[model samples]
Target: MSLPLYPEPVMEGPHGPPAADGPVNILLVDDRPDKLLALQAILADLGEHLVLAHSGTEALRCLLKQEFALILLDVSMPILDGFETAALIRQRQQSARTPIIFVSAVSDSETHVSRGYSLGAVDYILTPIVPEVLRAKVMFFVDLFKKTQQLKRQAEERAQLFREQAARAEAEASERRAAFLAEVSQALMTPLEVEEILAMVANLTVPQLADVCLVDRVTDVGTIRLVAWRGSPAGPVPLPELIADLDPIPLDSDFLVAKAFRTGKVQLLGEVPRFLDEISPRCDTGERCNRLVRLGTRSAILVPVVRGQAVEAVLTFAVVKAARVYVPADIGLAESLARSVVMAWERACLYQAAQEARREAEAANRAKDRFIAMLSHELRTPLTPILFSASTLAADPTLPEIIRDDLQIISRNAELEARLIDDLLDITRITQGKLNLSSTLTDAHRLVLSALDVCADGVQRKNLVLTVDLRADSHMLNADEARLQQVFWNLLKNAIKFTPTGGEIQVRSFNPDARRICIQVADSGTGITAEMLPRIFEPFERGQETSSEGLGLGLAISRPIVEMHSGVISAQSAGIGRGATFTVELPVVSIPMETGAAGPSSGEGGDSDAHRLRQPRILVVDDHADTLNVMQRLLQRLGYAVSTADGVESAMSLATGEAFDLVISDLGLQDGTGHELIQRLQWSGKRIPSIAVSGYGMKEDIAQSDQAGFAAHLTKPVSSQLLKATIERLLALQ
Candidate 1:
C-alpha cells in the first residue's frame, strides 16, 4: 500500500562540527537577565548567536522571529516554569522541535527529573553546569541539524530537475507524433498490400489516429461483413475478403455505412440507430447496432471514401479504448488514412476482386459449415436415444419389459429426427429453387381436423383439454392439403409442448373474408417474451429460453412452408407466461354441392380393420428379451403369426432356415445391422420383404438401411397401428 519514499538510512560514528570556524544560532531563555548571562558564558566554548529572553513570554516572542537549533533554559522561571518555557519554545512550529536542555541548582528526584525530560528537554544540568558535557551535547545536535539541512536542499534541487525533464519529454512526444503522421501521409500512396498496410496501421496508428481500427465492408450478398480489425477482437469477427467482395449495402437500410456512402458524407453515431430493422436480430440486415456499441465502441464516425461522384467504400472509427467521448483529434488522422487506403483499393479493384471473391466465398463457406455442424449436432441428439434402443434390442433380445417402453421413446424421437432432416433438406431446396408444392382442391376443415388427429396423442399426454371450433359447412381450398396439415400440426404440437400440464388449447377456423380463411391455434402456455417474438421464425435460432428442447428450426421452416401455400402464419403474445396465439390464413373459395350422382362404393364393412390386413409371415429380431416378447405380442395382436430372435447368429439362422414374408430386424444387432441375416437369406436364394428397424434414424442411418436392401425403414417404438399398416401395405403392394 505504501510506495517507496526514501532510501534506507545508514549510521556511522558521530563527527561534530568545528566550533571556532563559525558561530551557530543558539536560544537562551530565563525569568531574569542575570540567569541568561550566566547560561551564555557557560557555553561560550561552542560559538553561538545567543537569542536571549528575560521571561517565558519574551522567549516565545524571540524564538518566533528567528531559527534556533539549540535552547538552554533555567529549571525554574516565572509565568511559565522552565519546564513549561522549554515546551513553549518547541511549540513555535518552526523552533518547536529545537533541542532544549535543562540547567538548575535543584537536586531533582527521578519523577521531577523525568518531568523535565517529558517537556522535550534533551539534558538536565545541576546549579553549576559542567561546561564540557553541556558543550558536547549541544554541539552534537547542532552539527546533525546542519547536515540534515544540506541533504534537504539537495533533494529539492534534484526534484526540480526531474520536473523540467518531464515537461520537455511531453513536448517532444507531441512533435514526434505530428511528424510521424506527416511521414505516413507521404507513404500512403505507396502500393503496399493490405496485410502490410494493416500491419503498419495496427502497429502505428494508435497515438496518431485511432485506438481501434476496424474495416467494415459490403459482402457479395449485399450484407455488411465486419472485416480485418485491430484492437478489441471482442466485437464481431471480421472477414476482410468477404467485405471486399460484397455489394454495397442498400441505400435505404439504416446502416451508418450506407448513409455515409449514400450522401458522400461522414455520419457520426452517438447512440444506437432507432430503426427496428437496424436493431432487430431478425431483420437479416446483418448490421450491428447497440450491443457492440455499448461494449466500449461508442461515438463512431463513418467516413466515406469517395472518388468522382461515386462512393466506393466507407471507413468507420469508434471510441473503444476509454469511456471518454471521442474528441476531434481521435478520428482526424483515421479519416486521412482511409482516403489513402481507398485510393489503393480502387486502383487495384480489377486485379484484386477475383482473389477477394475466393476469400469471401471461403468466409461464407465457413459460416455455412458452422451452421451445418450445429445442425448435425442437434439432429444427432435425438438419434442417440433411438440408436441405443435399437442396438440394445438387437444385441440382447432377452431384455426386460422396459425395452418395450424404450421402443416407444425411440419412435417419438425418430419422428422428431425426421422433421429436423426435413428442415435441412428444405434449406437445400430453398437455395436451389427446387421446392415443389402438390396442390389440390380439398376441404380446408378436413385438413384442420386431420392435424388435430395427428396431435391428439401429444395433447392428451400433457393432459390438456384440446378443443377445436370448426364452422362445419365445409369450404374447399386450392392448396397442398397434406403439407398444410403438417404446418398446422407442428404449431399445435409446439403449443402442447410449451403449455403447462392441464392447460387448454383451442383450434378455431372461420372465413374472415372472401379471399381467406383464418385458422387459429391458441394455447395457455408460457408466452414468448417481447424480444423473442420477432425472431422465433429464424432458422436454427433458439431464442431466450436456455431450456427449450428444440433445434429452433420448427417455426422457421413452418413459416416459409405456410407462405409457400399462398397463406400466412403469424403469432401473437402479450409476454412470457401470458400464453400465445398463432393464426394461419389460407385462401379459400365457396363451392356449391353438385346435384346428386351415384358415387362408386363397394368396400368391406366400415367397422373393419380388415381392409388394411396383409397377414404377412413376420419375424422380429432383436437382442433384448423384453423387445422380443413385446413385438411377438404386438405382431400377434395385429393378426400376423410372428417369430422373434435376438442377436446376429440367431436372426441369421432363423432367417436362412425358415421363409418369412417380412423380416423386421434391428439395424444394430450383436454384430451389426441385420446384414448377417440378409446375407444368409440371399445365399439361400430366398428373398423376403425386409424392414430395417432401429432407433438410429439419422440421415446416414436411413441411407444405410436403403443400401442394405431394406423394404421399409422404421425407427423403434413405432405405433402398433403404423407397424401393422406398414407391413400390411407392403404385402398388399406385393
Candidate 2:
C-alpha cells in the first residue's frame, strides 16, 4: 500500500472498557471553541476517544473518574490555563504520570516552553494545529504509552530468558563435570589395584606441557603416598591428610582448588585474583619463598578433584609460574577442565592403561637403538687400524721393501685411525666447549704441504687436475701444527674427491695484507646448492647426492682445526652446476715458537730444518716383527747402527753395555712400559741419551716418557728425517 501522509496507529475511543481499560483516555481543555472542536475531531479520527472540557476544573472531574492517555490544554485559557490545568491533573494520584500537551496561541520561546512543561505538561503544541499535526501528536503519545507498557512486558520476558540461558549453560557444564567425577569415583571405588596410570599420565600428558606433575593417594593412616611423578619435584606437592576423615576442609583463603573442595564451587585462578578471598599461601622460606601476594600466583590455576561430593584430588597449572595469574573465567574454565580429568579417571581406565604400555615399549626401543649405535662406533675404532695396515701391506708393489712407500702408508693410516677414535671420544666434549687443545707453534704453509703429501695419492687416483700456489711470506706461525695440517688436507682432499676426473682444481695463496694468508682451494665439478650450503660443516652431515668419496667427517674435522689455529675457513659456491671453493685464512709471523717436535723433515722440512744430518748413529727397537724390520730399513737408507731389540731389557743391555751414542725404544714391550728399565739404567750412572717411540701417545704416556729421561718422544709414523735429527741432537750433547 502507498503510505498514508502522517500515518499513525489508531487508538480506541474513551469509555472503551471497565475501571482499567486497554487504551488510555485523554482530556482536551481549550477556551477557543474552534480549537477545542479541531482537537476533538482529530482525536476521534486518530481512533483515540477525546474528553473535552472548556475549563480546568471540568477536566479534573473527568480525570478523577478514569485514567487518561494524555491532556491537550490551551496555555492561554481564561481560567485554570493549560499549565495550571496540567498542575491540577498532576496533583491527582491517578493522573500524576499522565502525559499532557499544551495547545497555545503564544510563540514557543525556550523559557515559556520549559516553564509550561515543568508545570507537569509532557509537551507543548502551537495554536492553529493542522489536522495531520494534531492527529500525529495525539497518536504519538498514545503509541508511546503503549510502547512503554510493552517494554515493561518485554523486559520481564528478557530477564527470564537470560536466567534460562545462564541456568542451561550451568546445567550442561555441571553434567559434563559430573560425568568426569562419576568416572573418577568409579575408578577409585574399585579395589585398589596397581594400574599403569603413571605411564599413562606421562605419555598422554607431560613433556609436551607441564613443568611439574605429581600423583598423591592417601592411606587410612593419613599418610600421603607420592606414587608417581612426570616432571620436576618442585611441582605442587600434596598434603598427607588432605581433608582426611573430614567432610569439607576449611580453606580460609580464596585458593581456587581449595575453594572448590572447601565450598563445592568452581573457582578460576587467573592472571589476577578476583577480589580478597581466592589467593594461595605465600611462603617466606624455602625454594618457593619468592611468591608475591600482590603479584598473584606464579601458577595460573588450581583445580580440585571431587569424588562422592568430597574433595579427593587437585590439579595445578603454572602458566603464571612463567607468566601471569589465571583469571576468574579462567578459574571457571579450569574447574570444568579438572572435572573432565576426574571423570576420565573414573571412566576410561582401560585406555589409560594401554597408553601406558605403549609409552614403555617406545622408551625401550629408544634405549636399544642408542646401545646399538654406541656398540658399532666402539667396535669400529680399533678394527680400522688393523684392517687398514693389513690391506696396505698386502697390496705392496714390492714385498721386501720394508720401511718403504708401503710402510709409510701404513703409518699414515694408523695415525688417521687414531685421530678418528679421538674425535669420537671427544664428540660430547666438543659440543660442551670443554675439549682440550695440545697446542704448538709451527709453519702454516708447511702444515698445508705436509697434509698434501699424505693425501696426494688419493688425488692422483682420482685423476683430477690439482695445483698449489703458496704465497711468498713467512711460513712461520704459532698454532697446533697437526690440527692445521688436518684442516688443509681435509679441504684439499674433499676438493680432489668431489671434482670429476680431468676437472681443474686451483689452490691460491697470498699474504692477505700481511697479518694473514688467504689460501683458497677451488674445484671444477658439481657444486653445492644454496640449500645444502649451511649444514655442510656440521659433523656427520653428508649431503644429498654427495660428490665427495670419503667419510662425512672431513669438513667437520677441518672446521675445528682451523678455529684452533686462530683462523677461519669458509665454503662458498654460486649454486649447483658450478663448483665450490673452500677458503682458509691463517695468521702468520716471522719466527716459529717452541714446539714438541723432536725431529725434522723426511723430504718436507727445509734443509737445516733440524733434520739436516751430517751422519749419525741410531738405535731402532720394537716388539712387533713388521714394525722393527720396517724401521731398521728406513733408518739405514737415511745413513744412520740402526740396532734392533725385541724388548726394553735387550735395548738397555745394548745401551749401557755397549757404545751406542743414542737410543730409541718402544715404551711397550713383552713386559710393561719401559719406564722402570729406563729409570734403573739411568740410576746406575750410565748417562746414555734416549728417545721414546710408541703407538699410543696419550697424555700419560708423554708425561711418563718425560719423567724417565727420554731426551725426546716421537709417536709411530716416525718419519726418516725426524728420526735422524733426534739422534743427531742427542749425540751432539755427548
Candidate 3:
C-alpha cells in the first residue's frame, strides 16, 4: 500500500561517482529474505541501485520510488505473486514501460510461463538458477541503465552552455552599438574645416561599416567635388577608379550618384558590377563595370546629405573587398554622419565669407587714404600761382584800384581754398596718427574772434543773426594756434552754412570749471535726428536734410582736433526741426613763456638791380609748358635767375651745361620721372641743391624724396611765399 523509501538521485561528478552513488534501480521481489539476499549478492558487483522488496506489494511500492533497470520476481509468493505483481506493475503508467524479469520454481509449465510472459515479463528463471548466468544477465541491464542516465545529464549541460553563449553575444552587440555612436560623436566634436572633416569621416567608416567610402560635396560653382575617399587594406585600388573621381554628376544623368542627388534619397544597388549598365545605362565602354567586378564589388549605397530640403552632398559606400549585402542599419548610420558633415561645412562657409568681407573693408580703407593724399596734391598745384601773382600785384603801388581789389579777392579765395584742401589732408593724417602738431602759448578768445572774422561773409550772405559771447578770463592755451583756429573756423562756418535765412547763430566760449574751457556753437537750423546723432562725427556721414555738395568731413575732422588737445566735443539737440548745439571742452593748464625770440617771418632779399646780379641761379623742370612758363616768371619776379625745361631730358641737358645753384624739378615728367632727372644730375659729380616739386605730397612721397637727396619736397600749386622761403633757406644752408 506504501512506496519504498529511496535516497536522493546519485549524480556523476567530474571525478567519479561517490560511494553512495549508483546507476538506476534494479528491484528484486520475493517473500523470503534469503532469496532476496541471494539475488542481491549475485548483482552486487554491478554498482547499480538495488531496491529490494520481499512481496509483490513491496515491489510495486519500490517502482513508485525509483526507476529500475530490471525486476526479479518469484511466482511462488503467497499473495501478490510475480505474475500478478508484474501485471499490476504494467497497470501503473510510470512502471508500465519498465523491463520485468520473472524468477520461479514452478513456472516450467508452458501455460504458467505463457501467463507470466503475457504479464510483460522479459524472462522466467526456473529453480536452482545458475549464479554465473544470472550475474551476467543482470550486468547487461545495469550497464544499459547507466548509459541512459549519462545521456540525459549530457543533454542538460549542453542547453545551459547554449544560453550562456547567447547572452554573451547579446552583450557584445550592445557594446559595439555604444562604441559606434561614441566614435561618430567624437569626430563631430573636434571639427576641422570641411575638407579635413570629410576626409576624416571617410577614413573612420572604412573597414568597419564598409570596404570603401567616398564623400563628395557640391561646390559653389554648381559642380561636384570629390571631398574624400578611402579603401580597405585588402582592396588596395586607386581612388580615381571610383566613379566619385569622375566629372560632376550631371543632373540629367542616370548614374547612381546623380539619381541619389536628384531625388535626395538613398539608393541601393545589389550585384553592382552586373547591374552597372542597368543603373547607368549610358556606360558605353563597360570599363567601369568590369573594373568593379575585378575588385569584387558586389553592392553599394549612394546616400544624399540633405540639409532641410536641399541636397548638399553625397556619401557612397561599397563592399569591394568582400561580397556583402547591406541592410537598413548601415544606410541609417551613413545618413547620420552626413548630417553632421553638412553642419560643419555650413559653419566653415560662413567663417570664410566673414574673413573675405573683413579683407575687403580693410582694402577700401587703404584706398580711401590714398585718394585723400592724391586729392591734396592736385588741388594745391594751381592755387600757388594765383597766390603768388596776387601778392605781387598787391605789392605794386602803380596798380589801379579795381585791379587791386580783384587781386585781393583772388588772394583771399585762394587762401580759403587752400585751407579746405588742407582740412582733407589733415583728416587722412589724423586717422593714420601721422598728423604733426606744434604747441605754442595762444590766446583762445582771440582764436575764436579770428574764426568768427573768417565766417563773417557766409553769415552776412545768409542774412542770419549771429551773436558772439567770449566770457573766458584765462584764454591762453598751449596748442598749435593754426590747427586750433582751423577747428574753430570749421565749427563757426558749419553753423553759418546750416542756419537758414533770418535764423539765429550763437557762438559762446567760457570756462565751465577752473580746469576746463567750453566753447558752444548753437544754430537754429536743421537739427540732427536721433538715428543720425550717434554717427554724426563719423567721416562722410551726413543728415537727411543736408545737401551733398561738401565731403561731410567737418565734424569728423573737428572731433579729432579737440581730442588731440586733451579735449572732448559733444552735440545736443531736441530733435529734427529744432535747434542743435555743439560744445568743445579743452583741459586748462599753466602755460610756459617761451625763452627765445621768434624767428623772422621771411628772409631778407632785395629786388634791386644789384641784388638781381647776385641772385642764385634756379633751374625749374616740368612736363607742362604752361606750368614751366608760369614757374619761370614767378621765380624771376622773386629776383632769382631762372631756367625752365619741359621734361626730364631737357632738364638733364640744361643741368649738364649750366652751373645752377638750385634745381627745382617736377616729378612725373612726360619722358621720365623727376627722380631720374635728379639721379642724372647727381651722376654728373655735382652736389646741387634740389627740391622735389610735384602733385605727389603724401607722407610716403615726402619720405621718398628725402631719401633721394632732395633738400625739400613741395606739393604743386605751391605759393610763391613758400617757394621763395624754401629757396632762400636751401641757399642759406648751402
Candidate 4:
C-alpha cells in the first residue's frame, strides 16, 4: 500500500486572531495498514495535519522530517516494536517532548502494560481502539502547542520594542549634551569681567542640568568665598530672597565644595542627607543643609576648577525638584563647564593686563617725543651762532683764501652736526609711524647730484674714483625732494665712509620699464658680510668694518623713506672684500606741463642797496649772547638799523619805544616764548611784521607760531642769506 502525502501548513496572517495558531502535524504508527487506516479515520473530525507510518522504523522517519503535536504508537510491530520506536523518538530532541499514546492488541498482562507505559507513553489502549478518546486527546495537545507558540512570539516583540526605545532615548541625550556644551563655549569666549563671568557660569546651569547652581572661589588668603549663585525661578521662594542670607563660609568645614577643592576632584552625593551626615555631623543642623533638605534635595555634584596643580574654585549643582537625579555621566559634564569658566577667567585677566601695558607704552612714547623735541632745541641753539659767524666771515673779500677756506670748513661741519640731529628725529618719527611726506613733482637726477655734492668733501678726502651713469629716459617722479635727497645721501655717505683711499664709487640711473625708474649706487668698499646682509636695513645695524663714525641709522632710515614713495630699496654684496651695490626702484609719473618758478635762493643775502635806501629799523631778540651778537653784526652788515636784546622784556621795550619796521624774536626767551612776545606785541596794537626764529622746528612748533600771528617760522642754525631774505620779504609785505 502507498502512504499518503501531506501538504505543508500555511502560516496565519498578521491580523489573524490571537488564538489562530494555524495547523499542527500528528504522527500515527501501526504495522497493519488496517489499524493505521482506522486511527486516521478516528481523528479525521479534528482539523489538523495527520501523518501515517506503517512500521516503527517508518514512524521514526516521520518524526525526523516534521514536528508533531502527538505520536500514536502500536506495541506490536515488525522490526522495531512500538516501545523501541517510542524510546528512540524520545532520545531525539525535536520529538522528546511530543505526547505519546500506545495502541496494543494482545499484550493484556499487567507486566506488559507497565512496560508500555515505562517507554514514555501517555496512554495505552486495547485492540478495539476508542475513537472518541483518541480524537479528544490529539485535540487537547494541538491546542496547547498553539498557545505556547503565541506566548513566545509576544515575548520577542516586547523585547524588540524595548531596545528601540532605549536607542532613541540615548540619541536624544547625546544631542542635548552637544548643544549644552556649544552654548557654554560661545558664552565664555568673549572678554568679560571676572565677577560677570562667574555669574554667567552659575546662571547657565539651571533648570536644564540642575535646579540650583552655586559657585565658590578660593581667595588669596587660603579661604573659600561664595562668589556667585543662581536658583531656579520656579522654586517656592523668590530667587533674590532665597539667596539674600547666603554668605561665604570658611574651607575648614567639610562641605562638598570644600571637599572638592581639597581633593581637586569631583564630589557626588546621590543620597544627600545620608552622605551629608557622614561627611559632616554639623551639616544636619546647618542652615544651608536644612534649606536644601526643605527644598527636596535628591542629588548633588561639586566639581573643582583646577588650573595646573592648584584649585581656583568649586562649582555646586543640586537637584531639588526630586524628578531628576545626578549620575556618573553628569560629573564629566560638570567638569567641562568648570574648565570653560576657568579659561574665561584667565582670558579676562590677560585682557586687563594687555590694556594696562598699552596705556603705559603710549605714555612712554609721548615722553620720548617731548624729550626729543627739547634735546633738538638745546643742541641746535649753540650751532646757530657758529654757523652764522662762519658764513659771515667767509663772505669777506679782504680775508686770505686759506682763512676763508677754514671758515667754510667750520660752517660745513656745523651744518653736518645739524643734519645728524635731524636724522635722530626722523628715526623716531619713522618708528612711531607718524612720518609725513611732502610730495611734489621732482627730478630724481637732480636730487642724486645734490646728494653727491653733499658728500663731495668725504669723497675728495679719500681721493676715490667716482663714476656716474644717467641712462634712464623716464626719471621724473612725484615725491618728497628733501626726503629723497636724504635717502641718496645716506647710501653715498655709507659708501664714502666704508671705502678706503683710492677706492672706486659708481652711481647709475636707468629706466627698468616705461613706468619705473631704477638707480644703483655701487662702491668698491669694504663689502657687507653675508650674515649681516639680511638685517642690514634694521635700525642701528652697521657693517663689520670696524668704522665707528655713524649711528648706523642711515640704511634703516633710507628703506622706509623709499617705501613711502611707492618704491623698493635693496642691498647686494659679493663678500667682505668684493664691494656692495644699493639699488632703488621708484614709480615714475608724467612730467607736468609747467614747473613753478623757483623761490629766492638760500645763502644769498638781501640787496644791501635797497635795504640801505630804506634803512628798515629791525629788532633782533635772542637769549644766547653769542647768537644775539651774531644776529646784530649780520643784520648791521646788511645795511639795516639793527637793535639787539637778550630777552623778551628788552625786546618788548625796544619794540614799544621805537617805530620798528620788523621784529625778529627767538622762541625760548628768559621772560617769555617768541609766540607770547608776538601775541603781546599784536595785542598792544604794534602791528609790526614778525619772524619767529626758534630751535624747535617740528611741524607742531611751526603751526603754533603761525597761530601766534608770526608771519613766518624759521628753524635755528639759519644761514645769514636766508635770514636776510626773510626780513626783506616781511618788510616788503608790510
Give the TM-scores of the predictions, in the order they appear.
0.39, 0.40, 0.55, 0.71
Best by lDDT: 4
lDDT of 4 at 347: 90
lDDT per prediction?
0.66, 0.61, 0.75, 0.82
The digit string of per-residue lDDT tens for model 1 on 122-149 reads 7877766677777788889788777666
Cα lDDT tens digits for candidate 4, 1-734 = 01101112233234323545577888888888888888889988887888999988888888878888888888888799988888899899878878888888875657667987787778777867678877777788788877777776666655555556556566666667667878887888774688888888887777667777877887877677778877763457765666665555557756567777889999887778676576465544645464355545778888888877888778888877644567787787788788888788889888889888999999999888888988998999999999999988987999999998899889988988888888888899899997889999988998999999989988998999999998888888999998999999999998998888999999999987889999999999899999999999998888784845777889999999999999999999998988999999999997754557788777444554455566899888888999989889888888788898888788888887898988898998888898888888988999888888887887778889999998998887788888988887877555
Expressed as tens digits, the lDDT of each residue in 1-734 for candidate 3 is 01101112223334223223366678888998998888888888777778888888888887787778788888889877778888889998878867777787783568788987888877778868899998888877667666666665566655555556556555565466457656776776576466777777787777666777877766676656667888742345555554433556555555567667789999776667558656456666554344344445677878898877898778887786554556565566667667767777777677778878989987997798777766776677677667766877787899899999899789877877876676678777888788777798787888989999878877877899988888876567878888888888878877777678899999888987788898899999888898888998998776555662466788898888888899898988888878789998997666644569888656445333333467689999877665677778878877789988988888878888889999998887889887878877888897899999887776778888888888899876677778888988787765
What lDDT score is found at residue 106 in candidate 4?
76
Residues 1-734 of candidate 2: C-alpha lDDT, one tens digit per residue: 11111112233222212123265677888777887777777768666667778788788788878767778877777767777778777787877888888777787557679988788776777766777877787788898877766676566666666666667666665565455445444444442233343334433323222344433344455443344444432334332232132233224433344444465554443433332232234422221212212222344344565666766555544332343334454455445545555555555555557778889976875565445334433443343335335544554566776656556666556656655555553443455454456676666667777877877887777787778888647567777666677678777777776778888888778886768878888998678888888998888875547654345777777777678777888889888768999998878776745567567547543433443455455665667676677667666665665788887677777776566556677766776566765786678776668888765444445677998888888755454556667765666556
Q: How many backbone clashes does candidate 3 have?
A: 3
lDDT of prediction 4 = 0.82
Arrange candidates by TM-score, descending. 4, 3, 2, 1
Model 2 TM-score, all chains together: 0.40
**Superposed Cα deviation of residue 386, candidate 1 (Å):** 9.2
Clashing pairs in model 3?
A: 30-54, 381-716, 381-717
TM-score of 1: 0.39
